[model samples]
Target: MSVGKSVRLFLSEGTPGGLITAEIMNWTGHVVAAPRSDLAKLTKRPEASRTGIYLLLGEDPDSVGGMVAYIGEGDDVSRRLYQHSRPEEQGGKDFWERAILLTSKDSNLTKAHARYLESRFIALATEAKRARLVNGTAPGQQPLPESDISDMEYFISQAQIVLPVLGVNIFRTTKPAKKSISPVTEVAAESGTESPIFEIVSKKHGIHAQAREIDGEFTVLEGSMVRKQWISTAAHTYEQLVPKLKQTGVVVDSDDGQTARFTQDYVFASPSAAAAVVHGRTANGRTEWRIPNGGINFGQWQTLGVENEPDTD
Candidate 1:
């Protein structure tokens, strides 16, 4: 009978007396009746036995791809199938629409067999849905492929629908600006000083240097300085100073002249020391000349009250 059909059913005359009635509902809510004789055949089967197996084929009859629910131990297979076929008992109209009942012939339905049938039916439904999506077939199109069906095979053996597409964006990098170090003269002029003793040495090559004084010493602050024709700077600064100096034709000649020795005693004092003795923090030597025994460093001497002797004859 077609799905969703309300039909009176009769059981076997021997066991479990009384006739059973069931209404078969399709996926679309159409109802039909099941035959009483067929119901009787189902009831005659031994209870709780795995003796017989039945397949609920799609309405198309020839359709291979369809759901397959199993009824193993129930007294009335027909009644159980009817339960699955109901709209309210199942999840919804879609569930009953897709459901197909299967029963084992042998009255020995095991838990494992029932589970297997349940899983297979679900998988088949899922695959059918996916296939419809792939073919661009809307809902309620046609019966799914079910030829060469095997009990051992999984229902969703093939791939389903494909995923959608996406998009992305990109960007670029930028560089920082250079800092300006004005000459001491420019700074002194800006401050309105009488005569700025400090001079700015703009060396494009040979130890590109910048210096600030320590306590009472002419310390090589950073990079290298060619003082008295010798490399004299602190060891740490010299390591950094040498490579930068090399870029400008300034070669670090050790006692051996092969390897460079950063044994200079420059920057022995910190900038704070100079700032304490000198008024402002902005002080650089190399330009600020000084006498041998000046009270403060060369950079500090410039701001001192005493006169400074020149290094040049």
Candidate 2:
């Protein structure tokens, strides 16, 4: 059973889309989030004056996942945001439409702590492959005492939990995708049972793929053979769909270049998105995916699942 943790959120401006604050009970970390339009409102907050690491996020039309983010740290959280408000040609990022800042409410976060957190966030984001990162290069780890490292690691765990509740998903990933953000989630996989498996087998186009839903997200498992490339360049075919997956190392071309193989388990928002990538053109995933041996399509299985399911309180 999943245990519940209480997270308190406050709408600083009395509106859901405006300035917001998020915090967990017994946690010293404080989160302040706001849209680019609410910069003035965020700057006035006391947390902005403290040392912290932050994320600047925006859309990436070219990204297969359609999100881009920059992770940075600053001694004065407000100062760095101000600098990034300028034009890109003038040494500022113009891509972001929102910002999420993480500072200590107890004023215990130092510049070193922030830098360490920044490095971990960058590494975790890259490893997850859930979004495109704008950072140019990775930074070497900053040396910190053993105790501080342990405490900061705990801080990151709490941040991971709070971030998702606030709608930041860059830190989230499906478990089968190994080498993931370890500090981002602490839940252990339950014993004695496992999720049902789904597969796609086709002899004509020579495809053999396997996927299953995990925690409400559909996950395409690793080592699955998929279409090497989109067969059509028609109007319905999206540009660079499979190429972007390759670019992120989620899937790679086979030695013969005939089919692609997934390097790791990858999550898709829905069965349709997974099917679209597998077959290489716009696809109706519900019909393309199915159960093995008995041969039931995903749509039918989904409908049948509700027949005798247990209820939640």
Candidate 3:
């Protein structure tokens, strides 16, 4: 008869359960566990102190070999094993008909510990079954071979298939990091100019504004567009424009302590006149600008936009 035909049993603490023994017949009518003595040792071992995993190996002289049906652990390893070995329990069934218990003295089964024991059991069981198979014993009756044990172990290793003992988790958890952002500035274009120049405007006073070059046919940055104004090709481009406009006698002042500011005469005298003085764009104004603030960048000023307009005279 197949091992599945064997009756399975579970034993735990029962009333008057210091140690108990009983036996039952398997489907094959095999005289399994009649007054088995192996269980006696478990009853004698101290309770509530031991902890660790125990392996149960079946034994049958009449069969080619036996198999391992269960793995267990407890604070009292001896008592736990004894419960499973009771004749009336799995001990009487063909499944654990000739059971041998392999146990450790530790109570808590750590993940690593459980894994190690499982691997060891499979390795040993496989080897024994292979030897039996080679000896021409009843192949079907042979205990699990080392290879079979390995297969079983592999099967259990799968997260979905393996059911860990209560209170144990196969995976660990971790936390994610937090994200933060720094202040950003915006640039807007004024009327009668080429494209609006975008700059990094500082939040603190005495900071300089950092200028950025407008790209493509369109003069605009990420968040908004510059309209009706000439924007600088780049910060350096302003250097060239300032000197030429200065030669034209345009009076300039420091806009914010950082930028060289050209009065309306330099920027809006005439569209053609402004275009003639500037090479790349009407403004070409980055170099011509300075922040009155001590340390702000033009880029920062642009980000702040007109919202940072000072009080007019």
Candidate 4:
């Protein structure tokens, strides 16, 4: 189990949608997040001058639900930020509308350290695939002393913990059994028994999944099987999702090359997404997944709890 962390976020502008500074208890790293509209005010802060790595975020114009990001490092974070704030014709970045600056409160990060962090952050964001990386080339790593390398790794770990708090999910992966964030483990259960397992089966398409609702996300347990191919009537969402899942290894070919399987626990934004992937077509997950013993589907179970069962037609 991951230990809980205490993160303190101070809103400098005294509003929910303004400049914010965040720090984890007992850690030297600090994160300052601000909107593109407040760049001038943000650049004036003291942390702006520190050596650090930064992230530029914006919505991707090409795809729905897609984000664009760019990662960079500098000896003077403020100067680099100012340069990027200019128009693209003026040699500035134009794809991002928000900036997240990561710096050390103790000013411990050196030029080499910042470069090393930048290289790793880019690689990580690429792996997460949560956003489109606007970088034209990879920022290669820099050599550091062995001791300093270890210290920087710890700093990276702290950043991983704090970034999610700032809504930076570029490093989060869905494969972990329990997410490092504040994941909900418990589900609606009986008075004394554990949360009952639920399933969605489609013998025709060869789908058999075990899942549970946790923190509003439909989490399909590890080892779930998905259709190898979408049916002819599959929706456009299914067409796009399956290929991306295969690319991400959430859907992988069987050893026999006949079907695909989920290698680890995967969480979907909604039940419909999980169902669509499972059935190889559009689905109504609320009515599709059921408790074999109680004969109640997810929709009723979630609203009425374990004591009540849906009336069968």
Cα error, residue 306 of model 1, in Å, equals 99
Query: What are the RMSDs of all candidates, in order?
Result: 37.5, 4.4, 32.8, 7.1
Q: What would the per-residue lDDT of candidate 4 be over residues 161-276, giving only the tens digit for each residue?
A: 67877888777654332322211232221111123467887676567888876434477777888778776563566567777777766678777555578876666767777888
User: Any idea what lDDT model 2 has?
Assistant: 0.83
Model 1 regions more than 4 Å off? 1-37, 45-79, 82-101, 105-108, 130-313
**Scored by CA lDDT, what does every candidate get?**
0.28, 0.83, 0.31, 0.77
Give per-candidate clash totals: 31, 0, 59, 0
Better structure of 1 and 4 per TM-score: 4
Model 1 poorest 10 in a row by lDDT: 161-170
Show where candidate 2 strays beyond 4 Å. Answer: 176-194, 232-234, 237-240, 295-297, 300-313
Model number with the top TM-score: 2
Candidate 2 per-residue C-alpha lDDT over 222-273 given as tens digits, one digit per residue, 9 for 90 to 100: 9998889887677553436688888878889988668898999888878887
What is candidate 3's TM-score against the reference?
0.23
Please say which candidate is ahead in TM-score: 1 or 3: 3
**Regions of candidate 4 where Cα sits further than 4 Å from its true position:** 61-65, 175-199, 208-267, 284-313
Name the better of 3 and 4 by TM-score. 4
lDDT-best of 3 and 4? 4
Candidate 1 on 62-147: residue-level lDDT in tens? Answer: 11211222212133444555454446546312222222123333333344444444345334433322111111222232222343
Q: Give the Å shift of residue 35 in candidate 2.
A: 0.8
